[model samples]
Target: MSYLPDRVPLHGPKFAADPHAAYAELRRMGPVGRVELSPGAPAYLVTDYRAALDLLHDTDTWSKDTRPWQQNQPADSPLVPMLGWRPNALFNDGKAHERYRSVITDSYALIEPHQLRRQVSKVANQLIGEFAAAGEADLIGQYARRLPLLLFHAQFGADDQEGPRLEADMAGMLDSQPDKAIQANINFANYITELIRSKRLQRGQDLTSWFMDHPAALTPDELADQIVLTMLAGNEPTANLIGNALSRMLSNPAYYSSLSSGALTAHDAINDVLRNEPPMANYSAHVPRHAVHFHGTWIRPHELVLVSYHAANTEPGPTADEKTAGGDDGAHLAWAAGPHSCPVKKPATLIATVAIEQLTRRLHDLELGVPRNELRWRPGGFHRALAQLPARFTPIAPDPDGVSPWTSSSPYSSTRQDKTWSPKPPACATSGPLYG
Candidate 1:
């Protein structure tokens, strides 16, 4: 495989600052272009919508197993921790993929949508209560990043106290630093190992126990892999989805008011993010099973190919008006496509939608503390994430009865007898200077 001398590097502040520009440049190279994930790691990025769909659906030509390509990568490469072959459904094909995927699909199936929404609401309220009195908070740190971890802990039967440690480890693993990423992977593995061990000794009505009890009969190691895969895949992306959707809605006042007024829904914001700024932007790694010319680029057997969900979804084509007139929202590839598409999209969507709704309802006057353009995007190749989402709101005091705002009948209370979930515009000005 002849390498392109001018491969675009996907890491560092430049790409993060303006990834759309990078995608636009890559489009000039045709549907697919050469790009470096890290300094020395080169891979082909599919920047066209049709090409990405073709690659994702062509299981016959492309394979998910990464072992062959992994052999050539440096042991300490930051990409190794993320792209290296694991025994989970993500790195397998055909029957093996089905076997591993079934465990996840079946386990998630046990979590009903209503039950998951209630759990998300509970976690969201707790997170909100922590910062409700402060008047200012980093939503990323205080809420978006932590809510999914707590929810996953509850589902996996891990103690709530363990959430912080897991969050730290997961962050380290995704940070794109070789040493920290590698060490975090080890720590995360140990954490899962212990969780599985405890579950064996005392099974509970949790995801871990369900995986163990499933008729598929995953071995202890297999169970650990699935758990790690599920947690890593579910937590980070969901967190980013929530943050990105919040950022979009908060940045645009008209959209925010429409959301609050129930004229526009959280689902609309989420779908907009999915199309414009997907959380897991450039991922869904696939390698050709044999030498093949894909979209005019010659790919060798076992060479890495990644689908740029961001680029593909935003590829130049019909305008939103044109798409709407045609009754097409121009479906996005944010959840990926084909057989290996996100297994838990429904629950993930519920988590993000409820998270945004809960925050908006409780702190109805919330506004970004920093200008929208000044917000920092975390630098990484695979994830489209914000480093911080600082925001300010009018501080709400605890109820006279000393009950938390989440359950209190205070003016800012979120608790209501109506079980139905709907957006209600706050009884305050929606537009104002971000911070006084």
Candidate 2:
């Protein structure tokens, strides 16, 4: 007998707590099914691997525009903060998407990989230096969260003072409620406008300057929007990618040993994380140009269609041969696909790799400060992120040169017992802040 799964609610603490288990249930019901995003926003979620690819690639039939759906949505809906229309490539299609995407992708491509690696290493080392001496630190706030922001700031000609503010504003925009998120968006827009103006007056050796010279000749507003899109695309997902990979390494003894012993490469670990728990767990929302029957489910025209990367990667129907035979080793939708695929994927991967490699190499004995299960997953359906990656390593001396780039006020201190990190700590520990 065929089974009919109950309609699942995609928002709230329950879904965020253990989304994979929920996806497993959804797959059992059917590859495509109805689900509510937040309270009143209901949409169809695509859970199967084959179906997701089809939906992502068929942009001709499934446009990125959401005007059809937004016309009826309440002004105060929480999901609107996330899925609402914007002028950037993320929200447009056809010639507009091409124009925005051309400039953004070309600007990103100008940064040579080797040069980019040097910058990533520099930022990684500076961040590690700041926290390494403490012997115990929250990796998420101190390292994972700060590394990408600082790198982006450096490229945008922003200084250390701007780093924290940019991080906070973007975080608020990504994960806050409707009111706070909208305000954060406004603050960020103003900040970008100023940055672009500064670049126009005196061109710098940075992406912002390169963007100004591009042939697209974007208006000031378009320039600011594109920069915001590029920064947001790389910062949040890459941070979460690093965090999720570190969590897996610390929590699973076998994976840790493989990484330490060089049996598994950093790329391998990254691929594993991308497949099992992607940074953007639920994204690539598309609106069908017309009402159509997809995989036995009728989706209305312009309905918000979301792909669950976590579920697609874990679908149980594919045979071992099917899984390993044709697709690329990293054949996961974590980087997304089609024309709108992440443009900075190469740099993002390199950054995550160097960050993980540098941290483990510097603190050879680093271990999780809290129990594996006790680490709180932040509440959000759009991202799979750990609240804090508390970890402990042997204390080390501070840099003699006093040249560390970190702030004088260290966020981590050596308080935990001096032992190898444990995967089983008491459950009463509080969640750490998202940023230092």
Best by TM-score: 1
Error of 2 at 181 (Å): 3.9
Residue 282 in candidate 1, Cα distance off native in Å: 0.5
lDDT of 2: 0.76
Off by over 4 Å in 1: 1-5, 175-180, 319-330, 399-403, 416-436
- After TM-score superposition, the amount by which residue 193's alpha carbon in candidate 2 deviates from its true location, in angstroms, is 1.4
- Backbone clash pairs for candidate 1 read none
Model 2 lDDT per residue over 115-192, tens place: 666677777877787877788999999989889988898777764577778878877786556678888889888778
- lDDT by residue for model 1 (48-145), tens: 88788789889999999988789998766667768999989999999989888888787777666777777788788778888888999999989999
Residue 432 shift from truth in candidate 2, angstroms: 41
Error (Å) of candidate 2 at residue 112 is: 1.0
Best by lDDT: 1
Candidate 2 wrongly placed segments (more than 4 Å): 1-6, 174-182, 258-261, 319-330, 404-436
